[model samples]
Every structure is written in structure tokens, then in C-alpha cells.
Target: MPTSQAIQVDNLSKRYGKDVQALAQVSFEVGRGELFGLIGPDGAGKTTLIRILATLLLADEGQATVNGWEVRKNYRKIRSHIGYMPGRFSLYQDLSVEENLRFFATIFGSTIEENYELIRDIYVQLEPFRERKAGKLSGGMKQKLALCCALIHKPVVLLLDEPTTGVDPVSRQEFWEMLQRLKEKDIAILVSTPYMDEASLCDRVALIQKGRLLSIDQPGKIVSAFDKPLLAIRTNDMYRLIHDLRAFEPGHSAFPFGEYVHLSLRQPIWPEAIHAYLAGKEHTGIEIKPAQATIEDAFMELMTREVM
Candidate 1:
């Protein structure tokens, strides 16, 4: 482990029974004070990796260090130096919001007031509901309390596993803003999210699927690496457009994207050729134009490549 890295994982692999490989030789590093995102969909092993680093679970074969301490050899030390917020809200439902914070702080041999400066921004918002039961709080308020508890000890590293999975969009945005502020204090943060749009917010992201690492780099770099030109196509018949485009001779891939279908070509061809092909198929209102490659596009491309 380097001094600059807050967390380091090497060839970490974990399996459930004999068939389900939750993480397959997954390796990456989170630099100090950097916000690193583990981007993936459901059951993609994002949580597994986070748990390993958090010292909550062990890897079947591989090594991981948090805050310069080996996970297995120094579980206590790692746990003390890092904050972990699991995907699900894991707090005492009966305890008041302030009580939950106090409990976590006491567990770490500290008091909320001792580290009030570190969590002031979040705690202030939670002050109004300090006496409210944790279980009775709204989704956003619960999220805030969980984060405050995680930061009660003022850990150097933070591991958040899909913290915004079921949160409202506004809360999600606010949470990320809080994370940005946390980074200003030089606290390394490793966050996982299923949303591709959130990937861009991280300094760097590792795209994972089915327990395997697909790609790791800055969001912009990954998008820039998409070699093929992309086009957004839409027609009167949205459902048939996708199948028809995939059936086209020059089409390499066609997938529905919201109101339009994103099509990739095996080789560059004139737009007129695409227009003519669709027109021949009795497709009308055919609109095709160049589109920029996005993080979602890059993830889909990597998934397609992995399958092929």
C-alpha cells in the first residue's frame, strides 16, 4: 500500500458456495481524499467489495488494506479508521435520531460533541428530528442520520454501499454534495451506485458486472475510448425501430434509450444509407443523428464485449 492510497485491494475474490462468484480477482485503489465510485447494476458484487474493505467480510483469496492496515491482520484497526454505511439502513429503529448518533460515537470511544465539527453540516439538518425515532424518520432523514453515525468517529476512509439506492433524486443530489464537502477534509470515500449518471461525479470509477471488473478510469476517459460513432434513432414505431435497426446489414448494436434507440455501426456509413434502409422497411418519422457517447454507453459496450 502506498501512502497516497487510503484503500487498496489486490486480486480479491469471493464466492458463495461453488457457483456464485461474487468477486473475481477484483483489484483497485482509492486515493486519499478522492471520491471513488464503484459503478454497476444489481448483484454486480459492488457490495461484496465494499464489505471486504470495510472488514465486515473476508475475501476468499486476495489482499486488502484500509488506511495502511491489512484487513485480516488488523480488522480492529481498519474498523476504527474507516466509516461504513451499508445499502440498507442499519440503525436502532427504536432509538431517537440523536440517540443513534450517540450510540455509535460511544461504541468508538468518543462523543458526538467531540467530532461535531466534522459532521456539523449533516447534523444541523438532523437537529430538528433529534428526538424522532430512527425508524419513524423519512427516507432522507434516515440517510442523513446513517451518514452522521458513520462519521461520528471522524474516520479517515468512508465506505458507502449504494447509499442512494432507494433515495429520492433530491436527497441523492444532496448526499453527493455532502460527500464533496467531506472530500475537502481529505477523507477518502468509496461509494457504489447503480446509476450511471452518478459515475461522472467521482474522480474515477470502476465499472463492474457479475463480480468482474469491466473497466476503471475517469468517466470522461471511458466515454472517450468508445471508438465507434453513435447515432440516436427514433421513428413513429419505437418498438419496431430497435428490432429493425438491429436487423440492418451495417448495424452492430441497437438498444432502446428512453425516447430514442441508440444504434452503433460495425463500420461508419452515410446517414442517408440508414435513412434509406429504414424507409424501405416502411418506417416513418425516421430521425437519425450523431450522439455523444455517455458513461452508460461505455458500460453497455463493455458488457457487450465481455459477452462476446
Candidate 2:
């Protein structure tokens, strides 16, 4: 109920049918004007959690509040105070860009003129194709239109479920820039995404997987938490590199990162030991060097541990 925490979810849980646990005792909060990210892979309960906050779905247990209103009990009120953009395009395909915006505004009992300033930054990019049907627009244009529709109502909270998914690199950059601008308006924003690169853009992020949270903190802190000495390894026989590393007694972790495989050891060991081990296996062109930890590295570490 405090003004500071605009969104609060306490011990929330959800299930699909008898076996699938979508969320389990999940809990977190979003402060006013904070840009919070729910970072995870697909089927990680990110979408389920977003829907509950948007009042589109009910949780099987626990509580969630938006703008000091309980999500399940005050869904009608919560719906009006929150702007939601689903992962997929849910707008009217046949409607023109301007028409779709007007329709959403009408549903919320608001006129475009009333909150024109709120979406002006995002809508201008779509204005050139205002008369174009929503279906005819490119992926980026469609996203801009969706964002315009979501913001036109001037809601106190914004719930965006993977807003950058499938968008081009340039559009993704532009969209994140728009979000940065919107954060200045003091609206609590909760966005979900599987992209680890985007986690750094948020004020704070919750790394989640398999309906459970691995860690929640600023992106830098998450990376800093990885205290192990990391090394990037690659060899001519890259295919067998992982298996060899996994078989090593000192190997604590090994995950592929683009051209290099990041490996962490359980105890302090010299690089010579790793080199000697690989050389004895007849692997040629072996390359190994110190590496930095990233959000992806941290997530993979946690996810791998959860399974082990």
C-alpha cells in the first residue's frame, strides 16, 4: 500500500492442470518509476506472472497488487490503472494505426487529446503510416503502434511481456530507448524478456527459470556475484571440448559462449594443468584465456545448478 512500491507480489504461485507448476512461492516488488526486468527463458513463468499483474489471469496462490489494489479482488480497478502489452500482437489487424489507437482510447474512456503527450514520442514514428492497416506494417512499426496503444491511456503501471521479441536489432534498440524515456514519467514498468543483453538496461532484474527465481539484483551485481575465475577455452576439436572439460575433476562449470567455452574450476588451479590435459588428448589449436562473467554466464550457472 506504500506509494514507493507500486507493484508487490508476495509468495505467488500458479499451476496448469495437475503437474505443470507455472509459478512457485514467487515474490518481489517494483518501486515507482523503477524499470524492472523479469529475465528468463521461455516457459519460465514470465508471461504467467505478467498476466496476473495485468489482471488477465488469476494466481493459484498468494497475492499481487498493482497501485495498491489487489489484482484478483480489484481486477476491474487494476485493469484501468495498468497498461499491458502482450508478447504477441493482439491489436486489430484490419484497423489502421490511428484507428487502433483510437479504439483502445475509447475502451479506456479516454480521448487521444487527453493523453497526447504521454505517447507522442512513440506515436510519431507510426504517424507516417497512420492510414496503413496494422497487418501491413513492418514488425518494428507494429511494435511502435502497440506501444502507442498501451500508453495512450496514461496508466500508472506498464506491464510489457517481451516487447522486443522478434523485433529487428535497430528496432529493439529504439524500443529500449523509448522505455528509458518513459521511465522518467514515474510509471512503474515491469518488462519480461529472455535476452540477457537487455538486462543491463533495467534498474534491476529478476533472473528466473522453471517457475523459480535464481537471483534478483542489479545486472552489475549479478555479474559480480560470479566469483569464480573464468577462462575462455576453444580448440580445433570444439565438439569434444565440452566433454573433456566436464570430465575434468577440477571443472566446476563449462558453458558455450559464442566462439569460446567459458570454464570455471572448483579449486584454484594453474592454466598449465588445463593445457596439459587438453594436449594429452591430442586436441590441436587449443586456446584458453581469462574471461569476464556476464549475465548469461550467471543465469547459465544457476540454471545448471538447479538441474544438477
Candidate 3:
């Protein structure tokens, strides 16, 4: 049985101007304390969706609720209870780190001292530079400060929109670790990210595109659902390899992945034939191996299926 919902939406839709539909009848429910991720690429309406849920933007159609407070009716109450960290760093660049934290705490009629422990772990990283202007801080420092400000009031839900975008790899890892600690405290977290690797960090993820929900499942379950045997093929000449593989009939799908090409032979029986053909082409260090499909692969397959 499903647990109580921390957030719920029904047939949500949004549009800008006349032709651009930002969202299209999207609906999903997130359970209490669950780290739910909304995964998609740019222009996938992730920001718009988060804005709506945060009570910062009105939806064109449908309704939603956070912590049992109706979004449309009790937006004021909802806003007070939800912490939102936008994709862009929107903190006061001229303000010192400590000043920024104090301001956000004051907005919620709370004090940093009252809820200090809630943000203490994250704020300690920023404490050394507490007197420094936000603009002068590095990407990672800014990220930590932003998070501290957002959590200063101990909101029931944390909504982070692509919070790991430009930070260093070490910082990204640290940020995720902090999230793990937050989740342990039973705070519901909804994070949106364009990166696929981050999807596995969440308890469950909703693969979204064009403002529509594609699939919602545990990371491992979603990956297990991937049907085709994926192949990671590498060669000395990747450019020529891609051209040749695409030229093969049955219209195989291939995309550049790191140093290799992720190729899915359109037809099952053609793997051997394709391998032999590639070897005949005098490709050096030719390696073809069955590979696991990642969240990105599942997302691509879902998008392709949607398009078809």
C-alpha cells in the first residue's frame, strides 16, 4: 500500500503567451519523506513545475496540495512550509553570507539561533567565509550558503531545482551527502535535475519530458525494465565508426557516450554481423560489450518511444 502523500497534483498544466505550453496535464504524488526527483533536460518545464509547486506561479489548469494545504487556496500557508532553492543562484550577491541567512530566517518570522541546528551541518561550510559577499564565493560555497538559507526555517519540504549544476565534482558529492542526512530527518525533498547520474540518488524518480511524466519508479526497477541489450562499442576512429554503424540497415541507434559509442543494434540478430563488419573495416582496439542501461538510457528510450 502507498503511504500518505506529502505532495499531490492532478492534471496540472501551464502555458506562456499563446503558443508555448510549459506544462501539459501533468500529475503525480510524492510520499512523505521520500526523495523524489524530476529528471529531464533543459526546456523540459522542470523550473515551471517547481515554481508552481512552490506557490510562486499559478497553474493554468488543475490543482495541487503540499502537506495537505491546497495550493490554490492556501498558497500563503504552503509557501511558509516549503523551502525552495531555484536553479539559478538568486541570493543577494552584495550581501554577506551571514546576512543572507539572517534575511531568509527573518522572512519566515524565525531566527537563525532558533533553527540553527537544522542548517548547522550545511552552514558550517559557509561559516569560515560568513563575512564574505555572496558574489565573491565560489560555486560550491554559494551552493552551500543557498541551501543553509533555504533550510534556516526548517520547512517541511525542500524543493531544489538543479542545485548541482555548476559546482565541482567534490562539492556535488558533498551536497548529495547532506541531502542524505536531511532525508534521514524525515523532511520530504523534491529535486529536479538534468543530470541522469543524480537520479539514482533519489528514493524514486519521475522521468519527465515536455512537461509530461514518463515513468516513476525506484532507480533499480526502472533500469531493470530496460528491454534491449545495450552495447558500449569503442574503436580508434569513433567518427568513422558512428558513420558506418548508422549506415548499417535496420536503422541502428547510436550516440556518443564518453570515449565510446552507445550503440543499440536495431535488430537482435544483427549484432554478430555488425561486429564482423566493423572488424573487417580494420578498426583497431575494437571492443563491443553488453552494457547496463543507465537512467539516461532509459530516459532516451522513453523519449524515443514517446516521439514515435
Candidate 4:
């Protein structure tokens, strides 16, 4: 392991029973104070990988280290040095907001007054509702309380699994902003999210699918690696347009995006050629334009190649 890296994973593998492989030779490194993202959809092994590093679950093969401590042999030290927030709300819902904070602090052999500054920003927001039970708090409030508890111990590393899954847009934005402040304190942060748009927020991201890593790089680099000329097409009849686009022998792939269908061509060709082809098919209200590749586009392209 390198001295600068806060987390290191090498050829990590995990399986359920004999057939289900949750992770396959997944390897990555995160430097101190770096914000890293594991971007993938559900069932993509994001949780499995995070759990392994948190020392809650063990990997069947390979090795991993967090803050220079082996996950398997030094779990006690790792647990004390890292703050983990599972995908679901696992705090004491029956306890009041203040009580919950006090409980976690006590378990760590510390007190809220001792480390008040660490969670001041977040805890202040929950002060008014200090006496309110955690179970009665709304989604966003619960999220904040959970984060404050995680930070109470002043852990060197933070592991958040799908932290914003059920949050609203405004709350989600606020959550990311909070993460930015945390990163400034030089704590290595590893987070996972199924939302494609969230990939850009990380310094670097590892794109995973079906237990395998497809690509790992800066979000912009991943988009630039999309080598094909792509176009966005919109028609009056979306269903028919997709059917015809897929049947076009010269086309490589076609998938429906928000308001248009993204078409990837087998070879770079003039727009006039595509217009003529669509016009010949008697499609009405046709619109076509060049499309820039996004993280979602890159993931789709990588998935297609994997299938092929």
C-alpha cells in the first residue's frame, strides 16, 4: 500500500454460495481527503464492496486496507477510525435526536460536548428537534441526524452507502454541499449512488456493473473516451422511431433518452444521409442533432460492448 492512499483494494472478490459473484477482481485507491464515487445501478456490487471495506462483511479473495489497517485483522481499529452509514437508516429510531447523538458518543467513550465542533454545522440544524424521536423525523432530517452521529467520533474516513437515495432534489443538493465541507477536513470519503448525474460530483469514479468494473477515471475522461459519433433524434412517434432506428442495418445502437432517442452509428456519416433515411421511412415531425456523451451514455455504451 502507498503512504498517500487512504484506502486500497486489490483483486477483491466475493460470492454468495457457489454461483453469485458479488465482486470480481475490483481494485481501486483513494487518497487522503479525496472524494471517490462508486457509480453503478442496483445489484452492481456497490454495497458489497463498501461493506467489505467497513469490515462488516469479509471478501472471499484478495485484500483491502483502510487508513493503513488490514480490514480482516484490524477490524477493531478500522471500526474506530471509520464512520459508516449504511444505505438504510440504521440509527435508533425510537430514541430522540439528542438521545441518539448522546448514545453513539457514549458507545465511543466520548461525549457530545467533547466533540461538539465536529458536528456543529449539522447538529445545529437538529437542535430545535432535539427532543423529537428519530422515527418521527422526515427523510431529510433523519439523514442529517445519521450523519451527525457518524461524525461524532471524528473518524478519519467516511463510508456512505447511497446516502441520497430517498432524498428530494433540494435536500440532495444540500447533502452534497455538506460532503464538500467534510472533504475539506482531509477525511477520505467513499460514497455510492445509482444516479448517473451524481458521478460528476466526485473527484474520480469507478463505473461498475454486474459485479465487474468497466472503467475507472475522471467523469470527463470517461465521456471523452466514447469514440463513436452519436446523434439525438426526436420524432412524433417515439415507439415507431426506435423500431425503425434499431432495424437500420448501419446503426450500432439506439436507446430512448429523456425526450429523444440516442443513436450511435457504426461509422461516421453525414447528417444528410440520416435525414434522407428517416425521410424515406415517412417519419413526421423529425428532429436530429449531434449529442454530447454523458456519464450515462458512456455506461450504456460500455454495457452494450460487454453484452456483445
Candidate 1, 1-308: lDDT as tens digits:
35558998899999999899999999899899999999999999999899988888989999888888899999988888889999999999999999999999999999999999999999899998889999999898898899999999999999999999888999999999999999999999999999999999999999999999999999899999998879999999998888899899888889888888999888999999999999999999999999888899899999989999
Candidate that would win on TM-score: 1
Candidates' lDDT values, in order?
0.93, 0.92, 0.88, 0.92
Q: The CA-based lDDT of model 3 is what?
A: 0.88
Report the Cα lDDT for residue 150, model 3.
Answer: 88
Best by lDDT: 1
What lDDT is reached at residue 72 by model 1?
A: 98
- Show the lowest summed lDDT stretch of 10 residues, model 4: 1-10
TM-score of each: 0.97, 0.96, 0.95, 0.96
Misplaced by over 4 Å in model 3 are 1-3, 270-272
Runs in model 1 deviating more than 4 A are: 1-3
lDDT of 3 by residue, 85-173 (tens): 99999999999999999999999999999999888889888889989999999998898889998898999889999999888889999
- lDDT tens digits by residue: candidate 2, 45-130: 99999999998899989988998899878899988888999999999999999999999999999999899999998888888899
lDDT of model number 1: 0.93
